[model samples]
Target: MTVPSSGLRSPEARRFLNDRLDWNLLRTFLVIGQEGSLSRAAARLHLSQPAISQALKRLEEQLQVSLVIRRGPRISLSSAGQEVLQIAAELYGTVSRLGPALEEPAETVTGRVHLLSISRIQSRCYDDFLARFHQDYPQVELEVDVLRSSDVISALLQKTASFGLSLCRTPQPRLEQRLVLQQRYAFFCGRRHRLFGRKHLNLADLQSENFVSFTSDQLGGNLSPLTVFRDQQGFTGRIVASSASLDEILRLVDCGFGIGCLPEHIVAADVQAGKMWRLPPGDGVSDVNVYLLWNREQKHTQAEALFLERFEHMLLTTELGERF
Candidate 1:
């Protein structure tokens, strides 16, 4: 491959020069480029600012190029730094693809792991999982992104994410899926609503009530649980408002706009605080099954495997997992 014009002549020459280059120095340089400050990059990499500065200096000496321009408290990438950043990212991707062939011991599975999930799952379910993972695998750098379920699947397919958590599973031959949990949903209303204090309430009783709808990418299309439940119950209530944010849904419900169907975990605190009341059990509302998805074609990194194992263990053995 032809090398870019970053004071480098040929690929073979660059490779020969890079023989003495340290991987840690490259990592430090990339982190500095991302954070744009030695202090911030040091904090992220769990090193002192002076150590970070030394690493950058060593990297510059090895490459024989000025990579960054440092000001009072800020740093900007030089043209050479930008070119090296792109090449370093490509190198990182190549190393990541080596997967289990490069696996070290479980305790030393050190690398970056990219995970994608829906907003609800990230906020409500994976917080504790993330904490435990970080505690056990301190060397592993975890990166997470919250996106829509469809977008999460797309990221997995495009190999942009290592794994994804989604609400629904699609039939793709090239993708593998495992059911993470089955989340039970309940109808909720603000404490001040007419049905808040009502006992023995059922789906029929909510027929004419206004409803707040939260959008989701379901199997068929973009539809809200309220819409599905309404159709299932043959209820004719109108949707007073719609939003994609769970916080907005709660706010709208708390303001007495309308009742909404939400996962039990989401409204648990609200229920305990008496801000929302759960309607009695009914048939229209159904449990949602969440799945973990990954590309079957990609090899699993040791860190990714460890994360999956710990996540599954937490899901099956913990209180949060028991709730499902």
Candidate 2:
């Protein structure tokens, strides 16, 4: 057999480094880390004490370090074991996120977990956040597909999506609706538009305004719920165009094509600089929640649960509800 050298460290003595590391053993370590006892780890692994001990021994032998410290019946990890546990967690996590959106691997080398979400929500600055998630668990592959919220749900029901992210609309019992994120839409116009710095503009003021929207094919969608007053009052704006593409929508808004609606996360910078304004109070302007939905099966994955935890935590820290 032949070996190539990077020379940062000598090749490990184990001729079968890849073959020697059993996924089952690393998984056992993680369970022990959580359960904190050999008996519990044994029960969870459905193996006898000897089997679990041998697996642990094989892992330690492969790594050339003792991972667990003996202190009575309760075991704690040594420093080297702590490092292994941390790296194992990260490696296992990475393997679970593989795909175009998740492309970082090199952690555990796990396969793929696919996801679907609405374009509006998908555009809200998650690339940086997801990249950070990739740093710790690079093996997981992730595929993010953009569809209308209605299409997303349909896809989930048809088993086309492992998960879904979208706006919180009128709730239904068929799927689980988790209020994972909050989204607020702001009224916007081009810097060169006639209403650039207007104050106290009422909802009625927008009746004659040109309106650009998402294509009406999307469910619970097309026009934003925020723009309902215009359609309900027997008035329709110039209605020059509609699009599913966010980039095009932003371009149209920037070029003074029409009054535009944008989620709070997407337009915070423009609003801060005084380019967009909220419709004056008492005009029935309101906000909505950014929700996450998945099949009941999706709830079974540890990776998905961790993602929801981190996602909810970030939103809480940002105090998104108070911002609205």
Candidate 3:
């Protein structure tokens, strides 16, 4: 809380303000402001909506100012509320660092680093870093879950994941994102497709061919580049199938569902094994970047910090071309 120069100058007044303010109330208000809804903040904190409302009311009553303007079901911060939100965030950030600051360096820092990811990440640099990090920090338990790109972003926002590796189309306001890998995509077909054995084919040859792609392959979705590429090619065929899982998309394409755009490097084995064939426009394929994401406002443990530091160091030292 920010006090005027003459407001809390007396020790008694300072003690009164400090003793009356509840830290939990500040935390609840911060979440409410971040989420922009009492219900969403309650869900994030695993508390009831009435409880969250009561906390906000108590804090407002203590400060003698309405912190939020509620209309219908949504809520927005008032002018005073915005100032309090900033102070609360600063106070919370300071308090969150206290644990890490007080703890001395030990032989082993034991904690779990929960990582979320998109499916079938194919990178030599990522694999090598994982191997090295595991060897260096044996005591830190690592838990990973594969999810859709949207789900990965959601988990990071909810502070449920320590970090994520996924495709990103735009920047998120509350998260720190770093480009970790760039993957090239190409059109491919299964052996059952009519164009499988063609040797001399151009982009015009596949004009009316049916297409299959990821669920997020839309103009404003996570795979927007693929959508733009398809629109530019003037393909008249409809999307016959789509899936969120890369393996499922590959399987659908391989089963004659339709031609699909997939990462060239990841499907190299399938291309060689006769399961899939590369289509036209092989040399000038679109590249999508994979980002490392984490919530900037979330408190991180020493283990998570160490892992982030090591991974960031690797990214800084390695070349972009070498990541693939």
Candidate 4:
């Protein structure tokens, strides 16, 4: 094979170097060039001085070019070494980023994070976290689909959803569940309802009043806490209307269909505007736990994994009251 007299440029020379060259040799040469002494480089690399010398020798022999000019006590780069040092620097720059790049893969995540959630999530903490997550990962597309809590769980179990936010009474098998928030549900009436603006009411006052609620507001459903609460309160009023969507339930209540129960914080602005009225027994209302759910067996995309991990970290660090 014809070989180049200088660098590994000729096809035979390149093949020869590729077949015999060791990356550790190039790394040792870089250290030797940086420190200007084989012994110092050895110390920096935690290798013996003789090992460093042998590594440099092997690299030079493979390239068929002397890479270092050794004096009595110090070392200097030959012209070939200078050129190779620059190349080594470029390669090292790339190699050095592998760790931090892996650590911060979220920055480069360029895909969609599809989340299934129940309707009318009214948590400022959650909204703020999503806004910041978006700002940090601008390349990630976020898609949120509203569904019933059970449907959210079902999607997650089916691996169709990247993550889930839902009201959970019991943790489903094959799903990892974390409590994200506990929202207090309160009775509210619209402007046209008889109980609207009525103050100093008790649980008895609402017993005879017709009610409207979520489709899951019954025993053995996701919102069973609400059902248990109503049963405990001796509420015998018939459910006049029901829907899976909170917006529709709110509209039904607003149209004087009947009283409805909803998260208070979600409709604070409406209550303030006299669009709705919060009913009595303000302290003993039922609180439903909203959970973050993910299927453990499902393989997640980079964006989905990053978003879920960060959101879980936020949940761990933030208090429930603040998140609520």
The residue-level lDDT of candidate 4 at 98 comes to 71
Query: On a 0 to 1 TM-score scale, where does candidate 3 land against the true structure?
Result: 0.67
RMSD list, candidates in order? 18.5, 15.3, 12.5, 20.7
RMSD, model 4, all Cα superposed?
Answer: 20.7
Residue-level lDDT of model 1, residues 192-232, one tens digit each, is 68898788877679888888866662326434454565777
Query: Tens-digit lDDT track for model 4 on 1-324?
Result: 222346666798788776877777777787677567898677656799999878887777788787877689898888888878767756665675474356765566689999898888888889898997898789999999999988998888889988999987876768877778878888899999988888999888998888888999889997777788788878888998999999999999999999888888888899999899988777737888888899989998878877876785565345567885
> What clash count does candidate 4 reach?
0
Predicted structure with the largest TM-score when compared to the true one: 3
Assess every candidate by TM-score.
0.59, 0.55, 0.67, 0.66
Clashes of each: 0, 17, 0, 0
Instruction: Give the Cα lDDT of each candidate.
Output: 0.73, 0.63, 0.85, 0.81
Ranking of models by lDDT: 3, 4, 1, 2
Query: Once model 2 is optimally superposed onto the true structure by TM-score, how far is the C-alpha of residue 282 displaced, in angstroms?
Result: 8.3
Off-target runs (Cα >4 Å) in candidate 2 are 1-106, 120-129, 216-224, 232-236, 273-284, 297-324
lDDT of 4: 0.81
TM-score-sorted candidate list, best first = 3, 4, 1, 2
What tens digits encode model 2's per-residue C-alpha lDDT throughout 1-324?
Answer: 111222113365555666667887887787676456887677645688788777888777766667787788899987777766777767666655453235443464455567888775543335555776677557667888987766777887676766788764655445665554555566677786787778777667776888666664233463356556455655467667677766677778877888776665676776687765544433224465666676654443545555554453333233234323
What's the C-alpha lDDT at position 50 in model 3? Answer: 100
For model 2, give the 10-residue run with minimal summed lDDT: 1-10
